[model samples]
Target chain A: MGQATEDRGTVHTVGLGKRYGSFWALRNCEIVIPRGGVCALVGPNGAGKTTLLKLLTGLNRPTEGSATVLGQTPKQESDYLAEIGYLAQEVPMYKQMTAAQHLELGAHMNKQWDGQLAVKRLTGLGVPLDKPVGKLSGGQRAQVGLAMALAKKPKLLLLDEPVAALDPLARVEFLTSLAEAAADAAGELTVIMSSHLLSDLERVCDFVVILAAGKTQLSDEIDHVLKTHRILIGPRTAETANPAYTVIKASHAASQTDLLVRLNDVQFRSAPWHVREPDIEEIVLAYMGQTKTEGGVQ
Target chain B: MNWAMWQQHKKQWMIFGGLIAAFAVFAVPTGMHFWHVYQQALAGCAAAADCDQLADQLFRHGHDANIFDITKFAVLFMPALLGIFFGLALVGREYNDGTNLLAWTQGVSRRRWLSVKIGWTVAITALGAGIIAALSTWWWRAGNALYLSKFQPLDFAVQGILPVALTIFAVVAAIALGAWLKRTLLALGILVVILLVVQISVPTYLRPHYAAPRVYTEQLVVQGNKNRDHRPDQAPVPAHTGAIWVNYSAVVDSDGTALNWVNPPEECSYTIEEASTRIHNEERSGGTPDVYIDREGGPAVHFRCLKEKGYHWEVRYQSADRYWKFQIIESVLYLALSVPFVAATYWLVLRRDA
Candidate 1:
């Protein structure tokens, strides 16, 4: 309760874990997502991405450790839920209800619901607010579901795979509206969108958290990750040890060696090797792919 | 939130409304006709002094009793319909469609959400069941007076506040199971079984013991006394008309020991009456004489012989005067039974992960 206002608006988790029956869905998970930015959570399927989102929203209780979302324990604080908005996978709205009725539900159940904002966002994209959600197109339903999450005027909005099922055109529209909403919020709202796909998030997200096999492999600003990690192609040799940097992945050919490394210094210039800037997708795939071969299977 | 619940359950509300409308269609007309016949019968028979005959004429001899029978079934079915439509679908459908993540994550906590849902649905069920029970209670008045069965099991469930209480119990139980199972179809199946078991077992096991039955004692005539018309078993105990007979076969002795442990004194012995025997005459067996066999009286001499040993009959019964008291007690019991279910649903929704 005595924490500063800015710290309270951030999502800070420490050693958070969840187990189902005998299997742990997520363990030793730690990430702190700063406020006022769109954070992309990328992982392979079943990488505890959804689990982490649920934990933050207090939809799930962690089996071990704790999380403070918007300065409150999700399961403990009565007002904690009001600060966060969550949309589940597949965009689960009441299919039997019209989008307008869903908005009305939001109005009735939420104290700070912005019905006009949601209506404007949806109607701008030609989403039929009066039709039953079940009868809407897939992209339209996704927009309505997003409107429901956004209309609550939450400080932190958690969306699980919001654009995974949309067509290219619809995906563009969904992202366009989301970016517009984020811009409109003026840095008061923080959005975390989880997807296994990296390209869509790469374009829209400034912060990135990469999870693999129920553990966080990387969490940082996308620009920082891109700047600090690099691929170096050098002549092959048996000397693998290096104090200049840490290698994440290495492969050797007959006469050439390639190394993906996190540099000890982002400005370190390499004269003996040709260095290339890594794409965000390449960095995320490296993290996801590295864990797969090194016992990610458990 | 109240309006949200209605919007969510509008389809079920419509279906339940249709069910109640159907009940009204059947009950209103039949009830008026029944009341007319009953009023005319009372007015006609009051001067004619044929009340005994009229009781049989109005109930035991016509299709009029079927109206009461149908209404009884309707009363019994209303609660189950509420359980299925409102309770089973409340949370189970949300879980089925994955909408709980949407509903529970809104600006309200799961506890508040569930309480509003349970409270509103239970209130509606009680109100609807209350109206049906009241209507049926009014309708059964003619049958109650004519047939004198308001104290019986079939009539008791349909007559009083028990319907409202039982309906609350049904919906709460269904909600608990629905939350626990998280599947509407599965919850519906188990809820039907649970409601049936509780409804049947509670009455059979619990209702009879609510009030200690009156220990009605009387003595059958002793054998070898001045001839008694009819057999001793045919002797009717002195009880008010329409008093429910719980048990009529408990026999005891002067010292108040049950007759179950006593063997016959080298002769026939029974609880309500001594067993009779048939005596086939050795000589008159050839002629057709009143069903071809000579019938001898029951061991009336033996019951007199038993009376000589100081034995009597005890009947346990609930008099009809306690009907309203029983209604109150049972209603409280059912409402008590529903509290735990409401608690369980509360705990599951608030504590368990979605």
Candidate 2:
């Protein structure tokens, strides 16, 4: 029901932009995501996804406008950062330290660190606590990094391509652990994970934010996006523009035209076209294709 | 967070601690022995006239010479190495390995994390260097009455609190440069080059001016080697006593005008090189070279002649009493110079992206 997806003031930003020299990595990005559930941050390579994550975590400050997480500015350290956790693309760790030592570091660094939870998570993954992180496999290291982040008991977790280095199976296992942790926390945890594997995201994410060319192309509940978009097959010369539907993308063959459109409470039976609900992949691809240059639909 | 960082960098601390232990092993017992020997050599000597001979015997036969010979170079570079190693380990490697991203994103603030690292590094470095300086200073003091003065460059840099100060100064410089470059090897390379230039230049050039050298003018004297046989021309007169540093010396006429040469009678005119060669030839041919130029009236008789003609000597020197003052002054200057680097490093770390 609507109560399940209702926002609890997770993240809010106003005209958030970050510029490096003359090039803007993320510009005028205005996005709000509800609390709870896994949020998919889908974007092509160099689509400013990592830039947005860095801004939210206070690793880098915004060049323009503001960004707030958990109803507090991200720049303030103790007030907001303690409630937020971040895992970067590299999954960096002290190579010389053991898995147990990383957890020890977490306990020492974080005031609210859950050492028992960290130990349980690592042991549950079958990762030996005494093995140095450098000697561990890539999958094991990623799990260690994830455990450390989760052990901080953060309200919001920001993961930037956390599973990019993992094999497909390992990716699933990692996401499964993340899902279990989220479920255990119930409504207390909100996750925003960026990934290129749209298929993997489809299974785990309930909300999606699609970014391209330094702009937000789409932001909505995944169920709503999947429910609102439909593929229409009709005549090659069909005039598709109307108040009931908005054309997101269109393609044509010799005798047929296929259009992906956003419906505004319109009945699909009134049109002289076959209507089918588009999957998340189809909707993401259609939206990404439309913004091949520097334009996107918010 | 600070404790975690310390644990992560414990290996680096071990290496630093090992260096300090090695220096202590080399210095402590040897220094105590030297101090004992020195006290014995000076005991009950009313005017300390025989102390020089006793000290010389100790230097030639005891461990003082060997130790001094080795530590002459050790004191110049140990502090610099400590600085470079600590700087690279503290911040440069973290940046290079991209671990700062992980470290900064933790619950701890970046500034707090960096402050803890810097604070611990500086404290350990200072403490280690302080111990080394104390041992070296004690050893130097034990023999200083009979041998080298604290005014010497090596002794000045290694004694008192200067070593610790210089070490801190180098570390601050290394941290700032590493923060700017974000590369460990590059920062270390530049740090070595900078420390080398600073280590060689400051003591050699800048230290002499710390206190104005006193000038003295007196009559020239004809002197000989320890055997008191051969008389040399243009020998400088001994001006100030004790371990004063002679900055400049020259032979002058009666009116205090500089003299290029002190000519003997024209009948025995010869350069000192010619006189020396002639004397060598005499020795080779089994002939007796005159033992006293003043008495025999050879070409070297010019020294005695100039003495008779009121030829004078002028010398510029820094007396030994100002050694401690200069050491304190240089240490203060080094500490003062390090402040800006520390400020710059903090500023850059706070503002840096990721």
Candidate 3:
């Protein structure tokens, strides 16, 4: 991926950290994502994914170093906030308020709120405007929350485990809606979503950022990551020693060994081995496991 | 934004508006009827020497007595209720329900949201309280001379600018507490307790200390048969009238030792018994007697003895003319005290986690 630039990047953080009573929830999290990049933040539970998202959205303030989302400090200025849309984990809404009323409130509260877009999306999805939000199904509520976020027409959209509570069908529908929105925007809207379901992300995201134990393990264009990481299955000691590939993970079975390695480019190096491109899920799992072995579980 | 906010909270606003409007409907007419009765009674007693007696008659036979009683009762506790209902529900419920996350993530800044909410609350509270204060004050004016003085605790608490000031205080206090606590019911409970303490303590303890009372010392006198002690030998200090609030009344020795008749000395037994007898007889004849006795004899004899022994009377009082001044001072004080609480709430909200 290209380096983060003030005008080109939608989000960048430098040594960003968050602490609660001496317990660092997220620490030393440095990340850079270019504008209009569909980034997927993949991490295990307690991997600071939510913390990072909160910081980016200005829903939270970093306890450590600075972060710039849309080239402004989080939670500092209203103008910057206006350009970002954030959907929290719970999808909280006023139970007594109808969907139409919520839209009315959004139109009132936001200077750049797109009322027509919000109404069209809701009506198209068959979400009744007169029904109270409390009476809606779980999937409907999440869609409503997503609609609220998208209606802002933000420069960047942050979703924290948006589909974690959805059923299998609902999960697909949610992702489809998000992917459709990103497609419609056509390289103008930057969307960063955090999810444990790596497969779902693989279908939608072009950029991948892997985090574990409050630290970022890998962040790059998804194509670049896929091209650099490879899985080798071969004999335990039938390889030439070279400085080309860095071993990320390895497992030995009797006389055979399976090795996951990161390299500048995938190539054969005169070995009795089988090399295959590692999927995003395998790469993320290797990185998360690597952090645990390195004792980064603070 | 203002219009949308009004639409969102219109239900709560309507409830509050309905309640206040209903109260006005009941209170205004009753107050007018009270004024009518009060005027008639005053005019009827125009030829009489004592207008105080005629005023008392209005209190006894007034058609608005029940309504006045209910309205005063409402005023006494309405501050707490309003604070808990509007203040806690406005912000506290947002936290409780976690809608603050949705709200804060919107384009609106947290500070702007709070300022608008507080501004609306203050305006609505002021409107409701202003109407109640105007109607009640107008009604009380005609009968004030016969009823309790404006300096009295109940009278002072619900009049002029105090109701408005108190409404704001209640709401701000509730907001601060709600922000800190996060739970609506818990915050409301604490608000009620705090308001109760404020309502009772402000009048009973804080008010009396607002300004130093005037000290009046007069020579002891002996009245013959004017008091309950009809034996013609008992006398005591009389309370001051015409814009003076009596805080304390006592007969003292030259050394300023407060004399006690509730626990009279051994030497005062004969005088006390004789005075008690005459007072009991007068009460049987449906007369209200002012009774006091000393160890020497009846009040007449005892006061003469007290003068011979170099005794006098002392009274501590607040002037009625300072009533408006005290009200203004108290309202300002309440509003000023609410500032830090409001600041603390804002700080907590700013620092709170999602």
Candidate 4:
């Protein structure tokens, strides 16, 4: 009986979609993020990154397909919502309320709110507890927003571009808080942070999901992506594809054909072209770019 | 949730507290002075030979009316202020600030959040509005006792349960607009317009017709046919008539049915009798008979003439005694009208994406 609820601490979706009027903000999105890993949801602007996060948080309902967060169908039910903590892109807080008041609000609103944790996080950041949050700096407000989400002690934390508006130092500080919270929770917490900034996501996220247009390009372990994808410079006379590999991107020079490929097999194959392991950023960019060349992103 | 809601209300609460203090400071003293004046007027009139003249003097004094006018206007717009703060800003400002994202994503569902908010807002609004209405009504008692003008629009709109109901309606309607429009300023603009129309139209068009009006049919007095004392075409209605006259002059038949003529008050019936000619002949084959030329032009119909013919001028008016009855009627009307706004607010908040 306990295993049923325990098994749900993960996110899995099949062909999930959200449409606003005639426009689909997110569609045909299939991603699987198991519990405990920090997943980076990277996309271009208006790429449905926020849409996917909102769907998982139950802030918005899906227009098509299904999404299960922590093994429960996302909805407005308190139990379901309690299991997931959501911070919107703007990191909205009652501007008139102080950080301490926000904690009080969180405690009143959530069943398992940890006021001490929130207080500690905010106080450590030198965010004044008594001043109204609107009077605080952008970084402080974002920290308070994070503390609010953290205090809930949710199994799944869905943050939508939480640090998008902060300064560079503030961005690092915000990410550091997230990393610390994830570490403190050990493997009991799963965080999905969406942003178009690759460097901000690269340090904290062990898992990655590349979304572009209304569709998801790739979802996998970061380490796995780094290991599987290759930059192969083959002869100019050669074709781009082979039966054994999937070419994610390809370009040609007069002397050589440049290709970014994901390995289909693990075995060491005698290939004609030289291979170089591509970094996560390069792989993400390649996948994101692969969609654009096919056209019709907007 | 309570703390957050309190944050929303903090500004309004402070302002309300200040208003209450001002009213207490001003109303109590004024009320006492008016009471003193009223008692003195009554005591002086007891021994006076002409109490009607003294009463008229008291009515014309309007001792408390000017000061009460401020309170009256304050009570009037207090509900409109509720529309701006509670109704229009309730959901609309949250959306405006992008805070609904934070709010709706809480462990509580949107509908529950809205339900709690609306409950708190409406309860407190009605309570505050009740206080204002009651205070204004109590303060105006000395003057109302003198004039009994509670049925008048200005008096009715600010007194009794009517203000409370109007306030609830304002907030609820504003809430619906906020939810539907999803913009604070726009919702406020529309809400103000709606409330303006409601306040003006409800009194001018709807309040007087809350119940069927009664007819005050005067017994006609007959003067001697030779004497015609000029009574103005429309008699001036007394201030203390204890009714709001919708129609001051209407001719009613013996059955008390109002005539639907172009001008009902001008309707009259007459007949030209045969002429009895008075002619004198000095010398003729036969003596001449007396002829009455009054037949050529008979006496014009006069008030006394019409009065004797079972025609009386009726005053159509809503009775002042039915003041509370109409208050209840209109209060129920406003409250019932607010149900749709409440429903729409809930539905919109629940269904719309945060």
- Using lDDT as the measure, the top candidate is 1
- Report the lDDT tens digits of candidate 3 across residue range A1-298: 2243566567888999999788898999988898887899988889999999988877788898888877677773578778888888878899989988888888878888888887888788888889999999778888888888888888899998888888878878788888988988888799999986566678889998988899999989988898888888889886634477888888788998888888854455736768887777788788877433343322
TM-score of each: 0.88, 0.85, 0.86, 0.87
Off-target runs (Cα >4 Å) in candidate 1 are: A1-9, A75-78, A234-238, A252-257, A267-274, A290-298, B42-50, B53-55, B61-63, B221-237, B251-265, B269-311
What would the per-residue lDDT of candidate 4 be over residues B241-321, giving only the tens digit for each residue?
A: 663535345656788775443333443322223211112231133653321112124422334445656876677678777
Model 1 C-alpha lDDT per residue in residues B87-202, reported as the tens digit of each score? 88788778888998888888777777888889888987898899889889887878887767787787888878989988998999988988899765778889899889988887
**What's model 1's lDDT at B275?**
32
> Chain A: TM-score in each candidate?
0.92, 0.92, 0.91, 0.92
True contacts kept of 2: 0.63
Point out the higher-scoring one by DockQ: 2 or 3: 2
Model 2 C-alpha lDDT per residue in residues A4-41, reported as the tens digit of each score: 32343487777989999999999889888988878999
Please give, as one word, the docking class of candidate 4.
medium
Pairs of colliding residues, candidate 3 = B233-B298, B233-B299, B233-B300, B233-B301, B234-B298, B234-B299, B234-B300, B235-B299, B243-B320, B268-B295
CA lDDT for candidate 1: 0.79
- Model 1 residue B28 lDDT score: 87
lDDT of 1 by residue, A1-298 (tens): 4367357448878899999889888998988898899999998889999999988888888999888777777763348777888889999888879999999999988888899988988888888888899999999998898898889888888989988888889989888888888899999899999998678777889999988899998889998998889889888963545677788878788998878888887666575788888787777777787533443323
Sorted on TM-score, best first, the list reads 1, 4, 3, 2
Candidate 3 ranges beyond 4 A from true positions = A1-4, A233-244, A247-259, A268-276, A290-298, B43-66, B218-244, B260-304, B351-353
lDDT of 2: 0.78
Interface RMSD of 2: 1.4
| DockQ, model 4, C-alpha based | 0.62
